[model samples]
Target: MPSRRSFLFAASAAVAAPSLPIEAQHSSGSGREMKQLPPAIAALTDRRSEAVPIKLGEREHRVERARGLLVKNRLDALVICTGTSLTYFTGLRWGQSERFFAWVLPAKGNPFVVCPVFEEGRVRERMEAKAATLPQASVTRVYTWNEDDSPYALLAKALKEAGIANGRVGVEERTQFAFADGIAHASPTLTVVSGTPVTAGCRAVKSTAELALMRLANDNTLKVYEAAWKSLEPGMTNRHVTDLIGVGYERTGFPGDASCQVAEYSALPHGSLHPQVIQEGQIILLDDGCVVEGYQSDISRSFVLGKASDKQKKVFDIVHKAQSAALAAGKAGTPCHAVDDAARKVISDAGFGPDYKYFTHRLGHGIGMDEHEWPYLVRGNSLPLESGMTFSDEPGIYIVGEFGIRLEDDWVVTPDGGDMFTPQSPSLEQPFSRA
Candidate 1:
């Protein structure tokens, strides 16, 4: 297997391999002034189809691993309701509805699904496609209920048949309250516990296959940021920048989500709902990401629309140092709070923060199948850092009514230390590193 640094160096070089122009000119064909900007980064994404993707076999391994956790914890089984957990373990993409739909995997027996009667065919079709992942010998057991019948009763019966009618059952952390109540009501003898030990246990550590998808996702996102920044025009509003971000991601072959904020608006972390137009020489903050397969990448890059002021330069450099500290501090066996502390100390020492007053949020969050997962880089977490955990190393300093500076990149925790998914921004002059 290739090292994360070498893999990223190769991936970055390949994605930006095309000699797409660094600068281009275009007009709206109406009365608007022609704008000169960088070339669309999407052109580099044409090679995305060549990337190897996650295979079905890896998902099978996840389920078997979860079973081991269940037995060790002494829980009867975990009821996987409609969500990413279901898909993560079973490769079944399901949506949540008022009606009951769940997967009952007994720690000691075969895994079975409880679904609506009418949707059984669709469920079976999905299950058959992921044939290698289904619990052994449970293909014939759909165990469904109708609108007039109780799905909970059906699930209860399945549990009884599996010889786990009376024992502790772990409920998904995100399972709706009604589902928990319904499960408890259906079977009076079962105790419920949080499945974080199992869910976060399996998800926080990225498999090689999982890391590959994330690598592609973050690489594509950085390229999109490059293209989006190049395509910027002085008159464009936050919404316009957001649209082009989508264009760049789609052209790169991934569906994406993004938001933009300018000038004073950037001082607010999530940005304002009101429209803010980009102005040349003012602060321009571009933060967005795209999803590669089921995995996700979240990156935020901040730079000025034109020449940055001296104050902007100082603040930008400070935030950059903060990000660097967190990255340097992350490694195997380090406490989660230590990463946040490292970043916070940098900002505080620089006189921009007394603590959380300006550097508002935690250092970063663990990223995976969902945008946010476990092992967060926040105070009080105390979880020891382990290899294969990934997080955003975003550090920022906000000056209300003046400006804000933030630089974000995804990082994978390695055996020796942490490795970034893309190169860090070296200065305000070359935010995208076009130079």
Candidate 2:
């Protein structure tokens, strides 16, 4: 019987020989193969150079936390296939492709990655630098799959070479059923189980470093929101306003795929901003985000096109009250649902509880690496808010087809209290002139 350490050592040595795919090896072409080119990233303009840098230490902490959990679980290795988790651990910003490649992370050794040849250079140059600072050993091995050899075969071989046979092999929440089934069939001795909680628990809390990037992301989002507000016109269609917001994001050096959503009648919780032209008295809700580094910032702002109606003013006021109540109730050590209840109670007292429909989503979610992270603010989520944890303090009342009112701001639990990441606007009170 091989000791765990010896097993990995022996397998690593035995697998050192380079392996090529069958298609590449037995090409029937006229003695030459057509070479494929790497993907082209869109060229960035001069203005795009100002994109913010993400704090790597926070991400490193997230990875270390997960590694610690793996050790606690007595697992020999983890086969992380989830895109978000992969980025969190390796700092490699690759997306899911038909390629079926993966990163094999051993609990006590260097990480081994299997990817197409085209991606190896970027992954080593960029991601390897970040991985070097990981709490665990940062050595890495790379395997490139060719046309003949499937990436799945490479991954299974890599895992076995790492001595995972008859061992607990960790898999992600979104890992394909087909892939998992294939891996098990490849090695019947391997025991695969869900690694979601292990990953989620590791990423739940934000570190001080993560909070700093989140602050900057929120600030960037606010600037874009201000631009969107300035671009609004009485006759502009909803799509026009939305497109202008996208332009603002670009102007601010945000990534191309930055997320955005516009709501015309927030009172109708699901009301979407359509092609209708904005008139003098319509309310517009813009919920958007711009990517900074690898993290995301999600924020929402509401604006009045030209004037405000009496009904709109009352609705905005109630929504503002609910938002404030929730903020006040949010603090480190408080139950997650407390803030939700606090906001809901205020809306109920205003006689809009039944009409409100309990604020369409959770009070907020973690805001780093990915938009919706962990420690959600909803009924029955008892996780106590902790310092360094951030969430959106958005409270709203929707009445469907008529209008909706929502005031959203990002908040981080601090030693003193909740630190509001996004600043409130001076015009926040403008819509209340009808009172």
Candidate 3:
């Protein structure tokens, strides 16, 4: 599932007629009107000290690596617009707007930026801050255009000046279509190709520092989930649990959120906007995670409000074994699809069977700076697993109208196999208990 922020934004328009409870609406209590937090949630302390932001040196190294990839991919320049890719390579956290603001990294020269003339000061300020940490903090050239001027033309001219005229230029996968089209129109001789070869090529594998941040992110998310799970009470709505998760992340000093799907809604993977109230023996599934230093963690935990029935236990065990099977098959050099096959086999053998009838979605997805990124773990993907490559080991069995059980844990590929950041959920009753 996507982040709660995105999901809620998309689901806001579809909210049901029923009003949310007071506890679900407000995260923090105000004076006498403030509702008490569950002991488990209230007891959480700030864990900001455990997180470490990515260093400028590491980002610089990433750029150098991208340059080599550019040469290998036979591209002259790479155009990166505002998004995670831009932040991943440059460490500049700029928001995307109608106005054009981009970074053009040529394979052979210092990188440059193209932005609206008025925004130069703000852009340079951030660039200077990052440059301060570099050994060679040379001033990168900036090309600015007025409100009336076409930013794409300026970008094309800048590339021409940088000796990239009439060469193959790669447009980052996420770049806006208009921007890519404008660049192509302005310079018809320039070949605009997919930059995924260079971008995903570099991001597919995690560095030691990146892994550390992801590890902390996963750890923080697990703690938040456990606290929220412990705080769950019968009669409380799904929104209450979501609010608890938000509060738990606040205690950890990280921005995070989650989506709570109850009972029948749990069967619909991403969940529904319909108001749901918790009840005894009902299934509750929480999805999404927190971001620590740009790296993200995606985890899902499914459990029962009170005592779980035999059917729920059976489904949970099958999913748990499938998750384990996928992890075991995800060794270095193994084909990515093989991992999915391993998990699907377990679910299919248990009667959830026959290709996506009950077991829905891919076994997992590659995750890092973005929740869903490149090199997915799905059927027919021939890419071989490599050490340091991280992915979600999520396998699920969804039965329409009944309930769904999905076990997800962020794991990294190892030479021998894979290692999960946290221990898997052993059973529905004790979801967070360590085995």
Rank order by TM-score, top first?
Answer: 3, 1, 2
Worst 10 residues of 3 by lDDT: 25-34
Of the candidates numbered 1 and 3, which has the greater lDDT value?
3
Number of clashes in model 1? 2
Off by over 4 Å in 2: 1-61, 73-75, 116-138, 143-157, 256-273, 355-358, 425-435
RMSD of 2: 14.0
Clashes of each: 2, 9, 0
Where's the lowest-lDDT run of ten residues in candidate 2? 34-43
Q: Name the TM-score of candidate 2.
A: 0.76
What TM-score does prediction 1 earn?
Answer: 0.88
Worst 10 residues of 1 by lDDT: 16-25
In model 1, what lDDT does residue 316 have?
A: 91
Best by TM-score: 3
Tens-place lDDT per residue, model 2, 1-435, is 122223332343243332121112223433312122111111212244445454456555666676788888876667766477777666665666566567777776667877788877876776556645432334568788787776766776777777665677777766777767665565666677777656776766666656666776787777666655654556655544544554455545664222122344445443432335566666676665666766667666665766677877887777778877788888788888988888888888888866336456666666667767776888888888887777888787776666666677788886666778876542432522323
lDDT tens digits, residue span 362-424, model 3: 999999999999899999999999999999999998989988888899999998898999899
Against the true structure, candidate 3 reaches a TM-score of 0.94
Q: Per-residue alpha-carbon lDDT of model 1 for 48-109, expressed as tens digits?
A: 77456656667767778888889888888889897778777877778888988888778877
Would you estimate the TM-scores of all the predictions? Answer: 0.88, 0.76, 0.94
Q: Which portions of model 3 miss their true places by more than 4 Å?
A: 1-5, 9-34, 133-137
